[model samples]
Target: MKASDEFQAPGLDLFSFPPLWPGAPYWLTKPTLMAVVGAVLICVLMWAAFAKPKLVPRGLQNIAELGYVFIREHAARPFLGKDADSWMGLLLSIFFLTWIWNLMGVLPFVQLPVSSFLAFPAVIAFSVYVIKIYVGVREQGARDYVGNLIPRGLPKVAYVLLVPLELLQNFVTSLFTHMLRLAANMFAGHLILAFFSAVGFWFLFERPTLLGVPVGVLGVVMAIVMTGFEMFIQFLQAYLFVLLTAMFIGASLNPKH
Candidate 1:
């Protein structure tokens, strides 16, 4: 038989998961379960870390505190400043939950990132959008909130162009990009990893030949390298998502005139 007959490349089907059980609903797929698991894991970790205060933190508490401090300083404080502590709970959850969602893509038997599904990131981004608008309106008043979208000091005629542009950017573009950024990264990363892994599996195991062996080895090597790189990207995406959230909230609270 031809080697080509035995080897098949992975495709978009890699991202499409079936229900976990025979009778499960369409929504109860691997990604959905993993998302719920990620949320629960975050809650458990937070409870374990903070439920019992300790003067000298150790083990899980120490590790969790390190993550907390990292988000506060890098994600929250730099953007939210004085209000950082007040929003730590939300910021910390967003950072850790997002990280876990992305990390799921690498785990054995559960190689699907929840955020790879557009719905997951969309919901989170939409929530942040609603919160931003609410806070902006509350802090700046309805009139000022809308007015602040376009900065002053332009030619009077500029408002004709800038007004609509600013409105579209602030309301429509920001929300879509915020969600799509994270989802697109995760989706593309998972697809690349799957392709390389499929190549390695097919060439090495399913259709092993003298000529195919070297290609299989190359595929395996690339998969390993890409996995490490993808892991870094996963963490970076999580950090950026939270960072942008903090920035949006900060901007709402303190609009630049």
Candidate 2:
């Protein structure tokens, strides 16, 4: 058995998709379609879950109520304090939307997390950035907002350098970090899951050999293990994404201590 006979690993090209339609518009790739579909599905779920308030909460209402509590407690209350319930709707939407995007990656037919693509997360992160700034301005007057954002206790000599740096940190750096945190996790998770699935498929069926049997089994095991871990990560990332958003809003609403 020469070294060359061993399987070649998959590369980033695996994440790339050619045109779904050779002659159609270029933007209509699987990831784009999936993202749109996921958004629509979220709208439907929200409507179904809470269109009319129920006295006792059955089925979807029960689920919706639980979600409301979870999002308020975990993503909103700690940051927003007494004003938590006021922002539950937006926080809930962000949490569920991101979760659905990630769940798509693990679903049988749809194997890609739309958020793995940078555009989706960037859009949401930028939206949060815009809202955070807007709320800051509205809550603290333009002058005070700027005054509150930069570090307070620093010496006057440090202000010359720190002001611009802190402003950049508050806006631009937060935007980049918010988007990258979500996208990078989804991208890496999708790649890993795909790698193991590919290994299992290739070795167990496509070109089965005595030497490949153990490798194939290992791949299957790893894929399962990673899938469980990825699910945990998916939930955690969604929480973190919204938690950061709440923090941003909260920070903007009140001066830093």
Candidate 3:
């Protein structure tokens, strides 16, 4: 479809969306590919940096070390406590993995951000949720962990009413919501960007000069503005995912009542 014939952006039209190929596999979509590539790249980069442990770290090792220290001392330790060392490896892996995937969205050629897909972000969130639940149960025992929803000072009758509600509402729902929130935000943001970008392009190049060019220019302006917004959102979403995961870990560690 020509870009400027209609006022609406063609990119956002579900019926006329671009296909990567005639019939790509579910796992081979642009977003999925970007995520996979980003993950592999991060792994190789880390291995290259730290393979030869050095007394005087330089190059990538030095940069990687600084990152590790930040997450270990600041992110994991505060929430997971002294035992954070045990889980620090996992947290660092996830943090860098997430950061790289989000970073890929803006990079040329690998413009697709995997986390923008609901499936990808959902998988990550679910993984963190499972680990959080496992930690809580393992440390506190299932019974105690389950009992933690209700406060300690509640009366006996209140416990009967509140415990189930707390468990049903906060603990259970938060996990799902955490994943959905990230997925939804990324998904919507990416789509909006696509729409506006397409509209801007169509207006600039396809339609008649007087009408199409001016509208397209406006569209391009909006796209630039949104692109800036997307960059900010990308970082914020990554931060929220990791931060919430850590907070959940903290909650699980201390099963109250």
TM-scores of all predicted structures: 0.96, 0.93, 0.83
Ranking the candidates on TM-score from highest down gives 1, 2, 3
- Model 3 lDDT, full chain set: 0.74
Q: What tens digits encode model 3's per-residue C-alpha lDDT throughout 1-257?
A: 56534566434343122446778654555666567787898899999988896999998999889878888776777787867887777777777877777766667766566676667767877788888789889998988787775688767898788778788766678877877777677667767777777777666765547767877787788888988998888877776777677778878886555
Please give, for residues 76-124, the per-residue lDDT of candidate 1 as tens digits.
8888889999999998899999999999999898899999899999999
Query: Residues 71-169, candidate 2, lDDT per residue (tens digit)?
Result: 898879888898788888889999999999988889998988988899998999999999999998998988999888787777899999998898899
Identify the runs in model 1 with alpha carbons over 4 angstroms from their true place.
1-6
Off by more than 4 A, model 2: 1-6
On the 0 to 100 scale, the lDDT of residue 195 in model 1 is 87
True-structure lDDT of candidate 2: 0.89
2 against 3, candidate with superior TM-score:
2
Ranking by lDDT: 1, 2, 3
lDDT of each: 0.93, 0.89, 0.74
Which runs in model 3 stand beyond 4 Å of their true positions? 1-4, 10-26, 53-57, 155-161
> For candidate 1, which ten residues in a row score worst on lDDT?
2-11
